[model samples]
Target: MDPELLTIVVMNVMNTTRLVLHYFMSCETENDSVVPALLAAMETNNSRLLLAFTEQLHAVDRRYWARETSTEWWDRIVMHVWDDEQWLQNFRMRKSTFLELCAELAPALRRKDTRMRAALTVEKRVAIAVWKLATPDCYRSVAKQFGVGKSTVGAVVMQVCRAINRLLLRRTVTLGNVQEIIDGFEAMGFPNCGGAIDGTHIPILAPDHLAREYINRKGYFSMVLQALVDHRGRFTDINAGRSGKVHDAHIFQNTGLYRKLHSGTFFPDQKIPMGDVEMPIVILGDPAYPLLPWLMKPYTGKLDSSKERFNNRLSRCRMTVERAFGRLKGRWRCLFGRLDLDEENIPMVIAACCILHNICEVKGEKFPQEWSAEVERLAADFEQPDTRAIRGAQCVAIRIREALKEHFDHDSQ
Candidate 1:
């Protein structure tokens, strides 16, 4: 009840009692017993009025101040009842993998209980973050499902994303066993290939400042993710959060991979004899990337049978990276839609998703066939503008491509 209204009611009750007492006193004619009886009656009436007001106030309190507790979906269904298939369907990981992830992230995600409320458990926190990443549900919906506040959902996501990048990124997304990677490519019919490099755009909301810079050739706001994946569809390196307007080749040149390849510090010194030239280990890229001595791209313009066969074989080897990206976006559907996050934090989210992808791939988790349907539509491949390469470098790249073509032709014969 409003305080002013309560005050008015009390005042009216008191005034009525006083008026009755005054009228009884005025009408009294030497009758002391009558005044006493009337005073007792007034006291009883005032007590009843007070009791009624108290009950009304209690009713108002129950109506407006009650708290509605959540249904405890995470505690009831996800923790105890969900099977492995249910876990994969919702969280995009098996039950064992989810527990392992929580254990690994517990050091960073663990929180202390305060007097205000008990802190969310590490498993619950990780589940909240993974649920948000694996699905396109909004924060409020996620909060409702997890029985946490909407803001808590957003905070837990950033917290877990940061933890994953800090602890697991370097270990998971690394160039482990380079010789094995090369051998895998060899089995795929591409000789001396280490990894395949490609770029895809991740959609994001228009920023408050310089929003135009984020718009890609597809005319949608996005951030660029440049990745290097080995032959088994695992990411070896990732560079994310550049503006979509930037070209792939430009982004590649700015990365540490470019520096390592330029300084000859990335790969081993082993080389294979191919006709007059010895071919060093190289990475495969598309025409959008510049041709370098250590980077092999498909032949452009008119091609003879040998060049065509070489392009076909190189493309076959490069498809690993493409499929890796498809699975990444397919499993983590958050990347398929515009991320509702700040531009600065977008990179961490992307990095965390890539790390999770590698973990799932290394663990041999199954990718659902239904998820792949969205890959072709959501994967935006921008056409890069013409890039200028040094004539000396271009000549070396041309010789390497020609030599690889001859090698493929000889194999075909």
Candidate 2:
């Protein structure tokens, strides 16, 4: 085993234990217990560890208090403090010490002084919630492990999403970032492939009026999650619009994602002025969406060549998005299990996962991003080849799909 990797593992466990003790601290009792636990965990060559870990623990606590002045006001080192209405909120023991630390960076996060400057500090509360929900684990298990209630977990996820929107979204993603992502795919040999746009389906329990409209061909109630990903497969845009029953093409048209094609703009023009060019952004399809000047689809060929192989390769690259979607759905069972979230909150959850999936792509999480947000997001069914049917009967749909596919296939040679 690699020594560094092993050290990391041991450190992670030690950190967890240390955080737990903060919540359950008795300075005298903990002082008594610390040396023995360190000695118990020591290897034969490690007599110095008892003193070493204790010093490390104290240093960590000092740093914690240095950053959060209210750490000293808590009953235990693990106590949580919040400020609202400029008054001291009750000091409560954090069920999960690690989570509290993870969220303590925001200015208004926790303090004994507690005169509330903000009702919700988006950074500490919402951002961490988003991180937790995107990760794979049972909420109850998460609560038990982290020491928070399930409802708090849910609330935190929502808050994290809000924090991100207010803070990180613009910092990390730019129209320039979108263009750079497109360039990466072009270098991989997919020309004019600004990005691939597709819709996903997420299952939902019955809604009041939209019950029948939400029944998809998959024979379930679902909502459509439309997304835009570049050739390199990073998600630049996503739209969780319409019910599952709405066709992919309609979801595109109705949600105004398709409007970009007609309006001569294929990407978000939010705030910063983007040049008005009919930038070509292609969508890989199995025959469902309408063909527009900005879109393209694969051409079936009589014989396979480098060009054919190239198309196959391009398809393979674009598949990164679909793979991401599959992993996302698989990690969160609550998403697959009767999601009765308020209608507005659904997209926020999907967006949070998409952001993390993009981060994980630094390691290239398998094949590609998934387009199955409606059926199964971040889905990777290794046994099944990537192929699916398309349905486009609207005059808009039929003309758009056929035209774009022909244009792209012909250009490939």
Candidate 3:
């Protein structure tokens, strides 16, 4: 046994002794007749009484002092995630990117110096956590790969995820200056287009109480990842954790991004002057999002040649979000399967993935061929119905689509 573990066991025994004495002292006042029987049992080293008391203490003590095995899975597999390019991509990031993340996250994840038993290194803990997000493997499978207990794997996953949420999410996924947004979209041939908006469902184990709430139109339980992606395939804003049952329009309304866009805070109050009217910068969306001055959704139902041309152009721009989501789930394969976590915890994991996606984009991380394969796989399993019924701001939607239609028609001529 490790010296530290032995010391912990001795300390636990001593604490148990004090607790037993306190129980005896309390029993003397409450039940005088029972005290003699308890004393007799203790004196005799009664197996039943001692077993009951020691069993409860042992459960906690064993967990606290659980020894790390000598399997060296850290060196064999975890470290390989950083050293090999193929393995690094399989782990959902590049080598330099993973090390940068470790540097950013290490301070909070590191164990205190005063701990008696040594804890896993910060890099090891983070690698374990990322491997969980990057693959569909469960805790037991992951634990076996890492030579750690399942519960330890679970704890490390959650802890590293929480750190990512607190330290990285807001900083990495952000809406930058309005000019940057405009420039990014304009470079793609859609003038005044700020970004693209869309929603995707991340599969998760259904919650016990509200299982029905998570069932989407496709009949699978999932959590929705409603996002705004820039022209560069980076998420500028994300609203995760909505029930899969919710429509994209409803999810959009619930986000702070919606409030800002609706209130004219997202973009400059200045509007581009057309022949008869002025229009604010707009975000391109499919028919699922409500149309507003600052938001534009394509026309529904039958369309004329001009309208079809406009939709095509708009879709080309809107494909930014689709490709961004594709890369996101491709890089983080855990989103491909039903995440084995509590319902409340599913969002944190998704949010952390999004944050990492943006970091990879910033770092110029290329998606491997495997990422493209995952994208194709996901496209087949995830199907969404067109919810294009005119819900709100129909007049604005029509006028904007008409303007863009005329612009494209003239450009072609």
Q: Top model by lDDT, which number? A: 1
lDDT of 1 by residue, 1-413 (tens): 76458768887987989998999888847867999898999999888888877776766644354345574677887789989999888888899998999899999999999997889999988999999999989999998888778898999999999999999999899999999999999999988889999988888899989999988877889898899999999999999988988888889999999999889888887788776787889999888888887899887778888778998999999999889888999999899888999999999999999999999988778898888976666554333323333223477778888888888888998
Can you rank all candidates by TM-score, best first?
A: 1, 3, 2
TM-score of 2: 0.54
lDDT order, best first, reads: 1, 3, 2
Query: lDDT per prediction?
Result: 0.87, 0.51, 0.81
**Which regions in candidate 1 have their CA more than 4 angstroms from the true location?**
1-67, 377-393
Q: Report the number of clashing residue pairs per model.
A: 0, 38, 0
lDDT of 2: 0.51
Native-to-model Cα distance after best TM-score fit, residue 157 in candidate 3, in Å: 0.9
Residue lDDT tens for model 2, 158-208? 665555455445443333455576567667655445666666677667777
Clashing pairs in 1: none
Error of 3 at 328 (Å): 0.6
Question: What lDDT is obtained when candidate 1 is compared to the true structure?
Answer: 0.87
lDDT of 2 at 113: 35
Q: Tell me how far the alpha carbon of residue 211 in candidate 1 is from the true structure, in angstroms, after superposition.
A: 0.9
Candidate maximizing TM-score: 1
Q: After superposition, how far is residue 174 of candidate 3 from its true place, in Å?
A: 0.6
What local lDDT score does residue 29 receive in model 1, on the 0 to 100 scale?
Answer: 78
